[model samples]
Target: MSSIAEQDLADRRARAIQQLLHTPLLHRDTPSFDTIATSEQWLKEWFLRTCGWILIVDYRRGMARLRKVTGWIDSTHPQRSLRTGKSTFTIRKYVTFCLTAAALGEHGRSRISLQDIAVAVSDLSVRAKVSPFTDLDHKDRQALVDVLMLLSALRVVTELDRTGRDYSVDPTGNVLYEIDERRLGQLLVAPLPPARCSTWQQMAADPHPQPSSGAPLDAHRLRQHLMRRLLDQPLCYLSDLPDDDAAAVSDHTEHITQWLSEAGLALEIRADAWMVVNRRAGTARSLRDGSNVSNCALLVLPQLTAQPSGWISATHLATLVDELLDEYPWWARSLRNDRNRADAVATVLRSFDLIRPQSDGWRIMPAAWRWAARVDPACLPPSSSPIPTQPAQDDLFSVEPTHQ
Candidate 1:
């Protein structure tokens, strides 16, 4: 290929990678960043090579699916609450999703109405010795509708007449939908059926269940997996690697660094974890958001930095949140659920490796110092100062949290 052609192909691949990383899952009916990426063999191969994610392209169904096998705490996306306007997904919503998926599989229909779905879900849930859908309170009913909307967003179901969000307000409200059974079947990317599994722990055990020595490590595939992790996570720890992968990484360190540098990223090697550092990368959230959760996380950062032991109890964290709410009543007065606020803050912190949940409590990770001086400088007291210039008593980066 000519230089110009090569550049064009590189640009297209870059855009496609960005799309998959951000959205992860794609459906036939939804608007995708690049429709061509799904159909093109090269793009499909790229995803497989890089992430170990299986991109199933069912052209007949107009569906392109990425079956995720690894990475992150929440493999299945937890959507925002439509009725309550929260980022966190509640238990009610989770139960509703289970009911919905079960109902759809049992229906065996081309098209179905919302009321019909509700009835089907209720029957299925009751049969499974789970909560009956009919017994749902107004909030639970709304949650059911919310999960339906999420399904619609993924194009598993198409809204024909009234919107899914509309049904959240009025359960009795009539809405029409056309179910895409093929796409719905692809929604759950599991190796085994739920009936065979004893616990949720079995889900992530080994996505590819085969004899350990069946196949040798495909060098190209391994490289792609590393690249995918570099792009997907803030930090990839060496300790997290399987034996074969660790050997591959050790053998090809220089080559891997070259690949990352070519892709506009620099590798930061530490004792435990490796970071794909990009100084110019943009983040979704700013520190200035008036939301109580964001403010709480900001307030907690300084105290977290000042901790001598590098760990704080959940009780202490909640107390710190309470102090913040007391000081900034105007900021958090509208926030009703104190527990949810702390959970949300922790979620945000964990994403950036600022704090990790431990057996005792949440441990302050070394990467958290990046925000020590950056967040609410005027608001924090002098005693809870930023990380000291000199080397700390403990080597922060020397240790990695074994807890998930």
Candidate 2:
């Protein structure tokens, strides 16, 4: 291929990889469908080779799914609501989701009304000895509606009702839906059917299960597991991995780094952790987004890095936030309260694995040093001297890819 054609192909492949990472299930109507569909073959091979993920593309039906598997379950990322501030799914919502899916699978006809689905789900819930869906309860009704909306988003079901009103608004409203049986069948990416597994651990079992104690390690599977964590998680810590896997990472650092680079990601390796940074805008959340929580987290970083022992007591952290609040009067009004602001900052930092809770307090992780702010002489507090210099890097909190 010509240089121009080769560049275009590379760009398309990168974009497709990113799209699947952000949204694993891509429907025909999604804006990136054409790009992903065109690069289907490359994506399949690339994902399988790099992360052991399966990429399924259906051209005629217009859908693509990246069946992702990981050695560990990530509770941080959950199936969230598409509406109402995009809240994470609650226990009720999860139960309702499973019940609804079961009901849909059992329904003989492709067309069903919202009311009928509720009745079917309730029946199933009762038979399964779980909490039955109460149609009269607003919370119960809303949870069911949320599940249906999620299914619609996945293209497993299409709402036929054109009414502008939401089903959540009226529990008795009959919303018609046309189910796509094929898409629904493809929704579950489990290695085996739920009926065959009694526990969730069994359901999510790896096809080529990890070897028992003292057994020889499978180098290829180890690489796949490591790559999967790098691609799917915010950060991969050496301490979190088994000794064998950690050693593998050190032994094959160069190979793994090259693998990430080919996918348009920069591998940022610290002494204790690895972070895959995507230069593409909007690929992931950045600390510089100027949101209240993110801004606070950035401000809190200096305090975290300043600690000599790499640990900060919760009380001390709150005091730091209070001082910052007084210094930066222009901060969001919502953060006026010291405790709330401190909690928000800590939560955001923890989400990025920059700081982790310890029995004593919060331990500033090695990755936290990457975002250490440069102390300005003009803004230095009267009692506090400049923080000790940190190891140099190209940028501060920049998601832009950089060579190590």
Worst 10 residues of 1 by lDDT: 385-394
| lDDT leader | 2
**lDDT of model 2 at position 123:** 97
Question: In model 1, how many backbone clashes occur?
Answer: 1
| lDDT digits (tens) for residues 87-203 of candidate 1 | 557776788897898788878777788888888877887887776777246866676778887888778889788643555566677678888887778777664556778976775
Cα-based TM-score, every candidate: 0.72, 0.84
- Candidate 2 yields a Cα-based lDDT of 0.76
lDDT at residue 264 of model 2 (Cα atoms): 67
lDDT, candidate 2, 1-404, per-residue tens: 99999987776677667778878888888666797788778788989998878899998999888988775666655677887644679988999988888899999898988889989998999998997788888888889878988999888899787554666777657789999988887778776668899987788887776577745357777777778888887589888887777776766677678777667677876667778887765345555666666766676687678788889998898888777767656555676844467877877788778888998579988778777643232332343433334444434344443363
Clashes of each: 1, 0
